[model samples]
Target: MNPALANRPGQHLRIAALLCTLLLSLLGAGARAELQLLDGIAAIVNDDVVMLSELRAETEMIYQQLLRTQNQAPPRDALAGQVLERLILDKLQLAIAQRAGAQISESELDQAVAQVAEGQGLSVEQLFAQAAADGLSRDWVRDKIRNEVIIGRVQQSIVNRRITISDQEIDNFLNTNSSELLNAEELQIGHLMLPLSSGTDEQTIAATREKAEALREQILQGADFRQLAVLHSSGQNALQGGDLGWRAANQLPTAFAIALRDLEPGQVTAPIRTDA
Candidate 1:
């Protein structure tokens, strides 16, 4: 300490006052709140950010499906957070694929797209048109498809490296598990949904069926199915224009799967009763 300043009590008080003033200035400046008006990120992976709106969008569809399936679900916020974990996992898988140099060639991707289109009974252009109607561009769909393929490759590689089995073990496992492992098909589906409320009389149910028939006709006549879904579907996912996305074949209700099996992709089922 400088002897001159140390001897002066006034100097000590002045120094303490200066420190207090500086602390107050910082606090006051930091206290100002900036309002955010638009969407922002829900979570950040190493090289990717999952947007808040994206999480909400994904969860809303799942939430609707749960209700339609007669299953209890958590609150929207809880569902979104849970779904965010899945997004993070996908991001991690993608990063692993990138590190491994897993690649999907353009021709291979093109063929995959064609297969999906053909399976749906749509031309490639029609598939792109449907994707556009749902706010996804062809490039975006391609990129997503590419990422899925890469992740599958990387995961298969990881599994191959981790698992070990002798011929005897393989034979025993196959003998034990073969009967349990019945083959099942998966279906990627979309719906233009309408609900049938309970306690409705037979007359009302018939009327609802008639309405559904009319809409189905319009769809067959080339009216946009998504537009009709937005206008008439009672589903919470009506806002998404009634996309059911994808589900495993066994995941679908048995009756619905049977009905869906005969209908080509992009074809609307007659307004089936919600109770059905």
Candidate 2:
């Protein structure tokens, strides 16, 4: 406490009066702004409307993030449009997920936050401190994390339903090209996969890419790939150290086949994006 405040007998009264004044000022400002944001719609998505408040919040968040990470921001108008469009997509998907009864509980959001913290080698407190430094409130971060989770659920639910194929479809495909499929050369491949899920931010994608490149360099330097994969890979065979044995040329996906086509038996390629 200040020495003057400590010495003064009515210091408590002074502090309380100052707080009351500040609260009143804040309330007055909020009351003025609240009406416009509460009533104004930014975009309409079917039965739901995106409020001006939401657009402003998302734009502010992304604008701050870009300023911090890039040391500069694009023109505000362009950035606001981009951010608003993203918010609209999120609102649409989240509405669908809600209709499908998908929700992220508080515990789940907490766990996701913790996992993100762990991935960055930080504790929860440190993570929040960094987020504060980035001008992100804890609540805002939690909401973003929740949106990501729910969107993943919605996309998975919709895409799986849309793309499901019957056994007869598989049989027909096989029968259509039997000779070429039967005679195609097969490669015995062992590898890792790192999935970059939908709606991930550029910063995260860049960090992940750097990690993958570093691991690639280590593998080239004779570091044990299997152990490294087991430790860091998110691939389905991560527990088996990324061993996907004896895949046929016809069966190998285009990206992998192209990346690995020229490699020798013991060689590993750089990070490949199957989705891309």
Candidate 3:
């Protein structure tokens, strides 16, 4: 409001424009800072990039899911790495599927979404609202489901191409193991490894076996497996509560499959020693 400038409407307008521009510049700087904090390239997967924001969102989703199931989430740093690896794998598989001309129809996507909603005991709209409350957008959830469907299709295609079962083999399998095969269910496995170094003495090996046995006893006595895993496991996923997630019976090692075969849910296997 300089007296001389106040007499000229054009000068006043120019000054007002200048103030507005300055305010916008300040605001833009803040916005840029926030964007930098919230989003960036987390990893490079061939021609694709995994964003930090995506990793965080997935990590949060898994953490919340674990909590809902009454299981403790792993440490953030560990969980983030696990989520990032999964994202990278998904990206790679999606790329492969794309090259193989794998496509998900709109109906397929919708069906998959519906199934997810049903699994969560929510309507589609309610699922969207819950996702939003959890800081995920509807588009993200849809895209995630679509990608999963694509991956599944591609994997099935690959397996079908690789495995050939003759009529004789099928008949033999049915005759010998039909009941087991028919009754087999997918298993969600957890692992905790107490590693032993190479060339370790018998005394050290015996000590490690004793420790493993003690841990197994504690688990059988109702101690939380995941808590103990986080505290004592030296495995790669130690921080992830030693969770191995779900696996098919065929996907597990022969010994593991055998050991888990007769076990009921929540039952722990006897400690099995292995060379590190």
TM-score, predicted candidate 2 vs. hidden true structure:
0.46
**lDDT of candidate 2 over 1-276, digit per residue (tens):** 789778897979988999999999999999989765555789998888888777777667656655553455555565566566666777889888888889887899899989877966889889888778767789877888888888988888877888778999798896777788789888887777666999989999899899999999999998877656555666644434567878898778788888878888888888886673
Query: Residue 90's C-alpha lDDT in candidate 1?
Result: 74
Tell me how many residue pairs clash in candidate 3: 0
**Candidate numbers, best lDDT first, in rank order:** 3, 2, 1
Clash list (residue pairs), candidate 2? none
TM-score of each: 0.43, 0.46, 0.64
Q: How do the residues 1-276 of candidate 3 rate in per-residue lDDT, one tens digit apiece?
A: 588877787987888999999999999999999877867899999999999898989888767766665467667776676677778888999999989999988998999999999988999999899889889999999998999889888878887998888999788776877667666688998898887888989999899999999999999888889867766787645546788888879667677888999999999898876543
- Provide the global lDDT of candidate 1 against the true structure: 0.71
| lDDT of candidates 1 onward, in order | 0.71, 0.77, 0.83
Considering every candidate listed, which one attains the maximal lDDT?
A: 3
Clashing pairs in 3: none
Decide which is better by TM-score, 1 or 3: 3
Q: List runs of model 3 lying over 4 Å from the truth.
A: 1-38, 166-168, 174-256, 270-276
Report the number of clashing residue pairs per model: 0, 0, 0
Instruction: Compare candidates 2 and 3 on lDDT and give the better one.
Output: 3
